[model samples]
Target: MALLDADARHPITLPDGTLYRDTVYLKNVIDHPRIKVGDFSYYTHSGKPEDTAAILAPYLGHSVRERLVIGKFVQIARGSYFITSSANHPMTGFTTYPFRIFKPETFGYKDLPVRDTVVEHDVWIGHNAAIMPGVRIGTGAIVAAASVVARDVPPYAVVGGNPASLIRMRYSDDIISELLSIAWWDWSLDKIEANLDALTLGDMEALRRA
Candidate 1:
C-alpha cells in the first residue's frame, strides 16, 4: 500500500517526495516492473503503463529482454518513452512478420543484438522524447523535447530533433574535463548543500577551489 498524505490529491509519495499528484507527484504512473530506475530520478507520467507504453509495452507483452537502466539525478519529462529492442523484427527473413511468434514452441521473442539502453546520471530527457533501444545518454547531457534519440549521446551534450543530433556541448573541452572531474552529483549531500552557491550561480572557479 502507498502512504497517503493530506497535501496532494494522489498523496502517495515516494521516499524522496517523488510520485505524487496535485503538486508534481505522480506515484501511480510508475508501475513498470522491468525498468531499473536509480535514486532521485523523477518521472512525470499519469501513473498508467499504457500512457507510457513505449518503454513498458514490449516488456509487459514479453517481447523484449533488454532493460532500461536509469541513473541517479536524471530528470525525465512527461511523455518521454523508451523504445525497447524487442520491437525489432528479423529483417533477414523473407517476410517482416514473425512466424516464430505463432508457434507455441517458439513463441518467445528473440533478443536483439543490442545492448540495454542506459541513461547516465544527471541527464535531462525532455518531454515526449523517444529514446531508442541500446542508446546510451551520457551524464549531464540534455535531450530536447520531442526528440528521437537513436545514437549515443556524449557527456554534457545537448541534442535535439527526430534523430537527436548534437546541437552543442554544455561547456568547452577544458571546462567539461574539469566539470567531469568534479562530478558534483557524486558529492555528499552536506557538501552539495555547502556548495549550493557554486552550483546555482555557475561559479566554476568556486567549484574548482572546492
Candidate 2:
C-alpha cells in the first residue's frame, strides 16, 4: 500500500474537507517505473476503476486482467478524461430511457468496440481535453486544451479542436527523430534528477551533447 503523491504541490487534503498532514488519493493508482504523475495530474472519475483503467490504460492496462497502457513521461492534466469501457443501452429501447437493454446482441445487439488509450513518452496533454477509446497520442506530441480527440495522433504533432485535428508540427521531423533517438526518458531517475535543471529548459539534443 505505498503510493506516490502525483505532485509535491501543496499540503495534502483529503476529499471530505478533512486536512491531513501527509496523504493523497493518487498513491494507489500509481505503479509505474519511469513515469511521474505531477500532483496536478488527475483522473476525472477517481472513484471508478473501470474509468481510470481506460484513461490510464496505456500505462497500466495490459496483463490480460489490467486494461490500461501508458508510456514514460506522460503528463496528464486535471479535467482530462480517459475512457476504458463504455456504458450502453439496449437496442429496441432506443426511444426509451433505459437505453434499450443490457445486451443488444441478446436481441441482436451490435458490439461496440473497446478501445485502449495511450499517451507516450514526453507527451504533454493540455487541460480539459477528452481522449476517446483506442486513441494513441504519440510520443512528444502536444494536445491543446478543450480538444476532443477521437483518433490516433502522430508523434511531435500539435493538435486541437472539437474532434482534435493536427494543428502543425512543433518541430521539424529531423529534430523530432533526433530526440526520439536520444530517448532521455529511458535514462535512470538519478541521472534525470541530477540533470533536471538542464532537461527542463532545453532540447533533447542539448542533453545528448552534454
TM-score of 2: 0.63
Q: For model 2, what is the alpha-carbon lDDT of residue 137?
A: 83
- In candidate 1, which residue ranges exceed 4 Å CA deviation? 1-34, 48-64
* lDDT (10s digit) by residue, model 2, range 124-188: 77888877766888888999998988889999999999899999998888878877887777766
Alpha-carbon error at 52 in model 1, in Å? 7.3
lDDT of each: 0.72, 0.60
The ten-residue window of minimal lDDT in model 2 covers 1-10
**Global local distance difference test of model 1:** 0.72
- Residue-level lDDT of model 1, residues 96-147, one tens digit each, is 8877878998865564375788998889889999888889999889999999
lDDT of 1 at 183: 89
